[model samples]
Target: MKEIKTKIIERIKSHFQDAVERDYDYNRLDFSVKKETIPSILFYLKDEMNFKHLSHITCVDWLEEKEFEVVFILWSYTDRLQVYVRTRIDRDHPVLDNIDMIWRQANTYERELKEMYGINFTGLEAPEEFLLEDWEGPPPMRRDFDTREYAARTYYTRPGREDAQDVRETIIKRTGEELPDFAKKYKR
Candidate 1:
């Protein structure tokens, strides 16, 4: 696995002229490429390197960096390897070339990205609302989105909610067993 990943990184570095920043860990190779070069790089990997399966597309809003990181996970059946092709685009104008022609399933992930992150895929058809209906504000997935504030504004909560106690704390006081970190975040 390590040898294959090393070879793939070497091939990309040689062909793409140091266009990618390579990272390997946990048996996966991640290649961070430029937004403009991602489509061609992915096409080459798919056609020549046998990375045929488009596993999924993930988007990360880096509010501090003022950019959005888009990752395309690809799987190779023959090599039994996974490659993550990542690129960063301006958060304000997040647009990229659509790869729906390369992989049909891309539309689903692309549409989700569009709906969640306000990313626009130039060549893809305009996507309808996926999860949010008549959403009028900033993309909820962005870091700047204050979910607690949004919930308070969008939904009607009972009065005196500010004095609510943590449900996990009450449970721990009774049971003498601590709740997991995730459970501790919610209040009664």
Candidate 2:
């Protein structure tokens, strides 16, 4: 496994030069590449290196850095290895080249990313809302999204039960034992 990973790293380094940053963890190899070269690198991995499976696509919102990290997980059945292809794009204008043509299943993942992270995949066909319905305001998956505030403003909360009491107070009163910090949040 390590030999195959080393070979792949060496090949990518020789071919793409400084355009990629490589990291190895046990049996997984992670490559951070520029958005522009994503398609080409993925093509090389799929066609030449036999990384035929497109496992998933995920996004991470780095609010402090003002960037979005897009990850493409790939797997090679023959080599029994997993590779993570990652890229960072500007959070304000998160646009990426579409790889749906290379991997058919990528369209669904891309669509989800678009709906959840506000990422636009250039040249990819826009699908209807994947998981959200009539969603207003910013994307819900973003770090800046205040879900609690949104729910409080958008939905009505039922009144607490008449029997409800602070669990901490109840525990202290009954057994003379104060509830731990973790148990203090719940109502009895």
Off by over 4 Å in 1: 159-188
Model 1 residue 8 CA deviation in Å: 0.9
59-147 per-residue lDDT for model 2 (tens digits)? 98889999999999999999988899899999999999999999999999998999889999999897577789998888889989998
Residue 110, candidate 1: Cα error in Å is: 0.9
Please list all clashing residue pairs in model 2, or write none if there are none: none
Question: How much is 62 displaced in model 1, in angstroms?
Answer: 0.9
Top TM-score model: 2
Q: How accurate is candidate 1 locally (lDDT)?
A: 0.86
| TM-score for each of the candidates | 0.83, 0.84
lDDT of 1 by residue, 16-101 (tens): 87366566466688888789888899999999999999999999888899999999999999888888988999999999999999
Listed per candidate, the RMSD to the true structure in angstroms reads 3.7, 4.0
- Relative to the unseen true structure, what is the C-alpha lDDT of residue 151 in candidate 1, on a scale of 0 to 100? 94
